[model samples]
Target: MSHAAALTLPFDTDTILEGLKSWAACESPTFDAAAVNRMMDIAGRELALLGANIDRIPGRLGLGDCVRARFPHPSGETTAGILILAHLDTVHPIGTLEKLPIRVEGPLCYGPGICDMKGGTYIAVEAIRQLLRAKVATPLPITVLLTCDEEIGSPSTRDLIEAEAARARYVLVPEPARPDGGVVTGRYAIARFNLRATGKPSHAGSRLGEGRSAIREICRQTLAIEEMTTEDCTFSVGVIHGGQWVNCVATHCDAEALSMAKRQEDLDAGVAKMLGLRATGNDVSLEVKRGVTRPVWEPDAGVMALYDKARYIANAIGFDIAHQSSGGGSDGNFTGAMGVPTLDGLGVSGAKMHTLEEHIEIASLVPRARLIAGLLTTLGA
Candidate 1:
């Protein structure tokens, strides 16, 4: 198919927006297995309608199951394929739809998960749909894997994503495009950690000196962790839970923290500093546990090749494209780190992700979807 033809597909804006609204209304939070399962069912059914062979991978360890869809090459060449990596889960909890309902204000669509990924997910679907309608034939197979727990670091789906990426020749992550219209060619290394402090509890009025305050210990540690930030590595304590009452000294405090680094050495150094944090008081004890450790996705020759193709398509469609390294983690991080060529941030252009004000540019829907279709057609050729 010609690039011009691919960019001019009769993508019905109303139809695409309606589809996004439907998916966004489902509220598939990462922690809610049942809700995410429902989302997987919806996505699976849609993919099946598009003639894909669907496989419902079961959930594990309290996460919702993943849905895998395969579109075999028309010519029977299946040794290599294109992998479309995405997630259906959102950070918004259930009942967010009422407050952040899907609405269109001029060129933007507002809703929970719309900008972050739901928009991107639908973009992938429509891209393939348009490709099929155009009757373009590709020699390489196409696969789409929509996992359940990406918002929480993709703990369960990492292995599945890597395994699929290992077989495919290219991996495309349809995350939302950057605010400045750049795609992602590299991603930072990230680590999740939880810090806890334990101390003696006593009434503040009755025994002030006798009791050691865990809250105080945690505050001290938080300050230290915050101070560990540098030009490359950054740390933030996102969550904290502690204290009982004003009249009593708290016995326990816990915090959820994460660190991001552009380079592996910086990440290692930052981790060492975080782990080496000492307790201010002798009576207070500290416990630090590491959670997910996502390796940095450094740019490579393969990525540059992919970008060359993408740039060609963007130029064909009358726009300029750019690339940047993001601090956020995606399944692309896993694949790219494993030496698989990966291109990310091919979704809609929007902002305020993970917030109630999240939204996407309505005008970007057709062009971005066409860009994806263009890439697929080029790869298959």
Candidate 2:
């Protein structure tokens, strides 16, 4: 079949949904390396079935492994091609299926990780499958890199993502489409920080005056950190832990904070402010440590040209796609910052991400797949 004729062919929604459900049912949360590896195993099997050259990179820093699947070109030419970037890890925990079981209701398909990514990842795979079955030859090779650590700032896979992206001509991230079925051309800068507060411990029932409560100190710091939100930068404390016994004062408290900005300079200022934080009292001490960071990705000329191509493809597919600068960071941030033509948010359309109410539009599966397939055939031509 000709490439144009193959692009016009409709995908089997039921088959795509079946594959996605299998992925979502695996319950691969970011912190659970074993669970994430199981998710990778399923993806690797699918890619292998498509005659892809597969490489499974083992996990490091207690994280899950990553899978790289490269589809060969018909002409036997090997060069920098398209990189389909997605993540197998979801924010949902292992037992979350019991709460948000996979099901179809009206036009939406509900399940954990369905909207946040697995849906888009499966759709990308299906697009390639359909093209192969139709014998449509793409102009360039395609590589799909499914990592296991995107939900938590991609701590373990950032280097790998950059390495793969550097070799590819274009990078596409299926990270849930924008609300209006649009794609992301730029992303805000993001930084994570670890906070610790230390205080003197003492019996709660007696001699309480001698104790400096770390919990109280942490509470004050949390409020201060949150209050730092501004038009240019925003801060939020996501995780905190302290106190072991009710009868004793807490000696230490730890917290994780995140800051985001539209510009890198703003994020840098935010980082400096976070690092300069001081304790409210002399009896207790505060320590701030910076963690993984995703730099701001403003759309350059190359990025805008890439978006134009995606826009043309979407329009040809009978849909209009707008472009915008999003807040949340993805692996695209790394590639985009490196001056690569990166496009993101090319995933399924849905809402309620990172929550039990997450889902994807059932009607969005086929069209989005077609769009991806169109890009695959046209890019690098």
Candidate 3:
């Protein structure tokens, strides 16, 4: 029997919309620990009500806490099972809800974090709810882990996420589906670094030769770094700061650099090149600090098997499914690289992420929920 034919949603569309609205109303920006904790509290309550064991794991390294919900197998089998990964935090700051209210207009619901992931997170919850209401016995345990620092590279939770993935039979990340309705099978490896240059300051006009400008040194190195971009690896210098006064030779300059690569070897080569850069000017010195390093999610045999199962589920619902690789990185990167079967981008369908126009297609909500429900049921079977 088809998974879709075997499953049914316990709640209606209105219930899911209400849940999303409640989540979107609470602005849980990644940097604000309190705000993110509030969002987690709300979700914790909902999951607790559903008879799942809820744990609010405290955050370390200046990040908000994470909430983990467990639906153990009735048969008490405790090997590895299904894992659902998501994030409660978004890029939007507090008070954003005032400008971008959670309102429904025709087929789209406008709000902060709705499309980026609030919608997706709730859909996962609803899928589990559907399975429970149908009294279907799950063959394996299910775990839902929602972290608070994913928007900021998951620095505090990377180890925890990897640990969970190590124990999971398969991982699913509902991070907003691609605009073309394709799921992500692979993702680029990413690295972040901070570059700083220091030198002596002097008057630009009167003592030009007496000083070596850090700004000039940094600019030269920046150009060299940008030139390192290739089809396999790319570099971006996003934030640059230098010189307080235009008439004075800058004593210090700094820049934030981000690099992405399609392969691990390319990323290693790019990192070595970036770290090898030194001050070309005589009086200037350079410093580089490494930031987060996200491994590439390369498609493997396990990933292909998960995609085939997803395609089968989609086809049972009367729609064709497609898979693609992305340049962006997610928690899936850690899991996929760890050799776990990971299927990402299995969330609500929408476009314009990380902007005021972020919204989800109202029409796509229920069907996608049904799809998730079907997948969960099929996996349990």
Using TM-score as the measure, the top candidate is 2
How well does candidate 1 score on lDDT at residue 275? 85
The true-structure Cα RMSD of candidate 3 reads 2.5
Candidate number of the best lDDT: 2
Local error of candidate 3 at residue 281 (angstroms): 2.1
lDDT at position 153, candidate 3: 80
- What are the models' TM-scores? 0.96, 0.98, 0.91
Q: For each predicted model, how many residue pairs clash, with residues at least 3 apart or on different chains? A: 0, 0, 0
After superposition, the stretches of candidate 3 with alpha carbons farther than 4 Å from their true spots are: 5-7, 201-220, 241-250
Minimal lDDT window, size 10, model 2: 1-10
* Model 2: pairs clashing at backbone N, Cα or C within 3 Å: none
TM-score of 3: 0.91
Rank list by lDDT: 2, 1, 3
lDDT of 1 at 236: 92
Clashes of 3: 0
What tens digits encode model 1's per-residue C-alpha lDDT throughout 91-189? Answer: 999999888988999888999999889999898899999878877765578999999998888889888999899888999999999888879999999
Where model 2 places Cα greater than 4 Å from the true spot, the runs are 1-3, 74-78
Residue 101 miss distance in model 3 (angstroms): 3.0
